[model samples]
Target chain A: MSAAARRGVLPGFGLSTGFTVLYLCLVVLVPLSAVALRSSSLGWQEAWKVVASPRALASYRLSFGASLLAAAANVVFGGLVAWVLARYRFPGRAFVDALVDLPFALPTAVSGIALTAVYGPTGFIGRHLEAAGVRVAFSPLGVTLALTFIGLPFVIRTLQPVLEDLDPEVEEAAAVLGASRWETFRHVLLPALVPAATTGFALAFARGLGEYGSIVFISGNMPMRTEIAPLLVMTRLEQFDYAGAAALATVLLLASFVLLLTINRLQAWTRTRAGAA
Target chain B: MSIVVREVEKAFDATPVLRGVSLEIPDGELVALLGPSGCGKTTLLRIIAGLESADAGEVRHDGEDVSARSARERNVGVVFQHYALFRHMTVEENVAFALRVRRRPRAQVAARVAELLRLVQLEGLKGRYPQQLSGGQRQRVALARALATEPRILLLDEPFGALDARVRQELRRWLRRLHDELHVTSVFVTHDQEEAFEVADRVVLMNAGRVEQVGTPAQVFEEPASAFVMRFLGAVNAFKGWVEGDRAFVSGLDLELVAPASAAHRARAHVFVRPHELDVHRAPVPGSFAANVDRVLPLGAAVRIELSAPGFGGMVEAELDVRRSEALALAPGDAVHLSPRRVRVFPSREDELDSLTASGL
Candidate 1:
């Protein structure tokens, strides 16, 4: 018998497996490997120097730090938004629900320009804020704000279904057992929501790290300040330094992949613990 | 603690769910709110538990009015139909939740959790999560969790409704024993009449958002207050007829029904008979109706005979012991006689009698 015939009851197992592996390699692995190979041609010492320069290091810190801050803010406010969308009914609820996906559906560059217009020094809400000695545009905070705007939908969308599926009976059960509303939330509801919320946080954070279009318009791109790693890679490419751009892109890709993998593992752990319970 | 619910009324979006529901549950009594789905039994239980508020009513615990209090303030415990164990917690943690939420000492929480685990016979599975346990075990965990704080009253909403028949039976017996041991003022809602009769001290029958009757198992089973209760108790046959001269003159049956003395003057009535109370005979007899056997079904210990009379539009059922049915050799098209050993007659309300006859009962 042929190996394919002996594989299982299902037919064409070998052919399907071969196709799947080939498709993944061509679509995902090959492009990623090309970046690594191109960066390798620069020689390790030069590549290291390029990625670890004072300017490059500052950009790295701003990119990762702003992404972290944006993800943290989204976890709080995005969770509230998701909870409201899932649990309550108010005027324009359907409209507001549709609006959550605006970040995902709007062109990133359009959102960037819109956010800049709204939060610019002379803009609608920003004029009052600037007079109050707060600046949201053309700074590191502006970059973070832009990232937050783009990342909002990731967290809300991820947590919405999980929140909706959470049984209200359990909360009522807790209340009837003498837990106050806060206690019921903290002890019963929060524990069930944590895994999904963490997954959302990770997703939002990953999206923020790679965000380029939205940040470029709002961020002033000042070296060692508002400049982010993706912008630094783009600058390198514009300067005709392919190896430097490839190295920077490879570093961002590896860092994000590692962090996202760790977060995914954390989410899986929580899910398993919840399943076991 | 004893509970008294006074004329509780509730509505959902203008559709009335509970209409002036009132009941008194004395301390240490286990009552079952029995009804079909959508009858508002579960809603009434929720009202008493303080999980839901009545539009107009007062709920009192031990003579203290708690209508304005929240569920947390009322100190009640509720077990949901699907167990509702916290999926993120271990069995021990779920049982300990009430105490822990109250900020009880760690040692005290541990001790109480251990005690409850033992009570629920789940000591060995304390560290396991709800998903790791079988349905029966999850329900036991839910029960233990509810009982953790020693709440004055415990409410369960169709506690075994999610389990299969075998597991449901096992859990029913376990719940009966647990109630005996705890003796908390408890009320559980269930649609299963057998479960209600077997497990509850008293059964409160409900229909169409109204309390039909409240009595002990025997009382409700033997002397249902209304035709609705009689039919809901299951395996019942209703005959639309008139009662006069101490006999019920049914439309289709040739035999005369022995009506209760009090029902003798009623011009119109609905007479009900349970299948088991009916006897099937090979030869026609006085006070018995002639019927043609439509089918014979062996139901484990007994045989159910489906019969149809010439003039009766609907079929009547009779159950006989397995061995006796075998000796009689009853079959389809065989001529037989049926005599009801027990019957209940209620004065026919115009709407109810119309519905009963329209349903071909």
Candidate 2:
């Protein structure tokens, strides 16, 4: 009805958004555009050559592939953890709930050392796995393990509120209508959880895609296999090949931006269609 | 199908909710469990539907014990106070839920869904989800979904409790007609006396987790079983009184009576007078107490007059015909005389009057 639909959200119009835009430009836009501008010096063909080399493609495989696998794994276990913390009461539940966010608070380098010591071949759980001939530390699997650790809190934080808000009466109604347990879950509970679960999955996946520090100790920086895109970026920066590193960083930046925009659209769509919490 | 509940007892954290309650519901009759809030009416309905289990006792469907069965196995359709329709599903999908879960033929599910939507007069809105509909419409959808499998018994827990007054009145009539058409053995829980009396074939009055009285609407309304029933059914003016040696003396109103031998002695007593039971006369008649008119309020066809005798405990309320109000021509501060046509005397433990007022239900 009015041109300024967002006018009532806060008192000021020009002052609020103008200040916000200036802060965002200084904090994010200027640095990100500097990378894009620097990357243009190599020209498109030379940049493609650097990005499409066999070793570069292999790192991309480990980066995108392991991140996807880690996110898929987090969704299942994180959903269960959220359900338990939200719906049940047990001894030490509060402690367990607070522990879910430990990865977010701890320094990344500290966690990297701690994770390597725990999952190394000579470590406790690692020795048992070594007997089963499964190597986790210093492998792509280890990279995935690190991503899963960092990405878990996003999934749990997103799904927990949605689970808490679910109406138990819906399940009761389904049961009284002659639905078995599996039928009730499939038809009622799963459909209700889908939108929230998708949002959680996207958030965790995007987080996993950009993870660094901890992955270096676990992945061992193998040039053709376990090496990830961020490590390769570090490798070029250490060698002072600034333009080459900027091009790869720009690729990662665009991917993260596209994911963030998709998540935004998804949230707006869900709020309209399913009344998502 | 008929339902029989025998000595059912339920408790939450050792606090008794339903205490050894028993009931009998005849086949194909719509019965209402009516009481104030927290009176265990809904708990009894849940136990009957097999949604909740009793701590001790049994529920029977058609004389067969179903106490051990789950709600899904009992075939009793339940509608909650809030319509529990799946928000993600369309109206047609919600109505067809039970049939599809049972793996019925696809064509049969579609046909039954259509028929139910038609019965509820919501065929046009079948494609819309539950969130898009109005409150009355959503409740109608819930009703249609509950009736999808043609359940042998229907249990509704305050089905229209959340609706506004006008919508509640319309739904009450529609439910009565639908029950008449289907003739399924039905039980509904309600705190509203009017809704129960209008829609139910029989009414079961419960209080403090026990069945106080059960009878047809006219029987219970015309003849209440106890002091609680009388107070719960209508507006009453309770006066402090005492009973001694087969005689009861009521304070304030200057009245006394030799009641039954059961009330020969009591710690405290009460004399209850319903609003309609009081007779307000313009002239001072013999055997009537003198009172002063405090206020006059017109209630549609009837006019209510509030009067206060010089020594009365509280103001007395009397309902009179509109014509009689015009005849008496009473106003505030006007002198009047009033007497009760009927009164009930109940012996109680000491301080019962204060407790009754405190427990304003």
Candidate 3:
């Protein structure tokens, strides 16, 4: 077929392509490049020195570390929640399923306050944990907890459909072929679910990295201890330290972008592993 | 091994799927459970394979009871209609799965897999994934995987149903040949009568979750036990009337259809005349019914002529060779005489009692 005939079949391709490029440039590309331009006002050496400061490096460690830890924990618990919702039926099952998305619907600052109230030194369950010598509300652990709460919806939403779409016949085939129940799960079911689970993990991890509103109230913001990267950028901006703020923001942006790019490459590999299984 | 099922019953969520089904298969026989959808053929197969437990039944293999055994313990191989081959695994790995699960030596697994790939004529595609292969190739891989452990019994549920017609025909012949060579007791479920007859030594016809008849293909087709069986193996003309003694009186036509010796006296009767059994002629003959030709369909090997008899509510079909049709010069609106060479008499079904709705043409 000629190009015009082919194009006629799907009439709005050029319109959609132009609209997508224009919208993406306006919303995302321009803002990201503006941040880069702002950081370049301080020369490369000056920006590098600002990002390499002890306070900035400490904040990076806490922000990235807590986000990584929280996302890993979410994969395990979120996967369990998704499987239960997808595979089982009980009284109030629908209510439990709806409850999983509460984190997404709640305002992030409200989540921060709510989590602080629940995990503060004198709160319910927190008093018992405090007596057991585990301080939570004003520690780095609190920041991880806040990130975990906000990141859970991403994993559960991504994984629920994948778990529900799995064919029960494949499991039966494995059983009749003399595989044990555990064998069927480990060999057949796990392989089919891995790609979707990986995708969910990546989304949750990325969300956790950019998290700020929920962590401020929980994390005490102690320099070189519990302070996170986004809080450092905000503090620099508040103090009229524009160059310092730009440097910190640029470092964080690069780290998130590189993490997302690597994750996409890994997802492509897992997708091939999980197809049709 | 010989297998016997005694009074199997199953219900899904208070809905009865199988009601008191039972059967027996001698060793080395390839049997088919043939029926339409929802006839409990697949459910029965699952019960026999130990993948499903009957609400009430006892399944015995080689005179040993294994009703309580799990599917993994029963050691029966099953293939599904959709070729449930693992998508992530290569053909070689899929075939080797069962042996590997059993912790067989690596060398033995490899050798057995190679042999099975050869059996299915898919050795050349051993390294290919299930998605990379065609439907026929994937199903062949499923078969090879099911055969890996050499289970005493093999059960297949509509194994070739997902393939195209041409490929289904080829696989049907291939499965029959494989059974002949191995002589392993096998049971396959199918909705296709032709495939069942072609592959199985004995055909068990089922309806409404119960076995209607069990016999060789020739016996079931030639001597149907019930009117339902006769109607199911269709393309035959049914003439409804009444049976008295050894003769059936078709109300519209003056001809008297001779009833079989096994016929029973009934208020409403049906005489089944296959298309090939009706001999068409140009001249009016004694014991022949007069009919007007409605339409003629050329079916390659044989020509099928449809006739609407005067006073009859439904059309009667007659099939003859190409030469016979040409000689008679049959056409639309032509007057023709038909004499049935053979007919089977059975009580007409409830709907067939009023001939208008029987054909549904």
Best by DockQ: 1
Candidate 2 per-residue C-alpha lDDT over B262-323 given as tens digits, one digit per residue, 9 for 90 to 100: 65456466677788878888787654677888899999999988888766675888998899
| Deviation of model 2 at A235, angstroms | 1.6
Docking class of 2: medium
Better of 1 and 3 by DockQ: 1
**Residue A120's lDDT in candidate 3:** 91
**CA-lDDT, candidates in order:** 0.88, 0.85, 0.86
Candidate 3, lDDT over the whole model: 0.86
Show where candidate 3 strays beyond 4 Å. A1-15, B252-266, B348-361
Q: What is the lDDT of residue A54 in candidate 2?
A: 89
Score every model by TM-score.
0.94, 0.94, 0.94
Q: Tens-digit lDDT track for model 1 on A230-277?
A: 999999999999999999999998999999999988888988988732
Residue range with the least summed lDDT across 10 consecutive positions in model 3 chain B: B352-361
User: For candidate 1, lDDT tens digit of each residue in B1-361?
Assistant: 9999889899999988888888888999999999878888999988888888999989999999998998888888789988888888899999998898788999999999999999999999998988889989999999999999898899999999888999999889988988898899899999889999999999999877778899999998888788888888878888887776556667644334444636546578778888998888888777678889999999999899988876654789888899889989998999987877876777777655222233344
The fnat scores of all predictions, in order, read: 0.95, 0.78, 0.78
Candidate with better lDDT, 2 vs 3: 3
Residue-by-residue lDDT tens digits, candidate 3, A132-186: 9999998999999999999999999998998898888888899999899899988
lDDT of 2 by residue, A232-270 (tens): 999999999999999998888887788768877886676
State the lDDT of candidate 3 residue by residue for B1-361, as single tens digits.
8989999999999978888998999999999998877778899999999889999989999999899899899888788878788877788888999998999999999999999999999989988888888888888899889989998798999988888999988989999999998888999998788889899999998877788889999999988887667766657888777766666667644445553435455557767889998899888877688889999999998999988996655688899999998899899999878887877778656543211123342
DockQ, candidate no. 2: 0.70
**Which candidate leads in lDDT?**
1
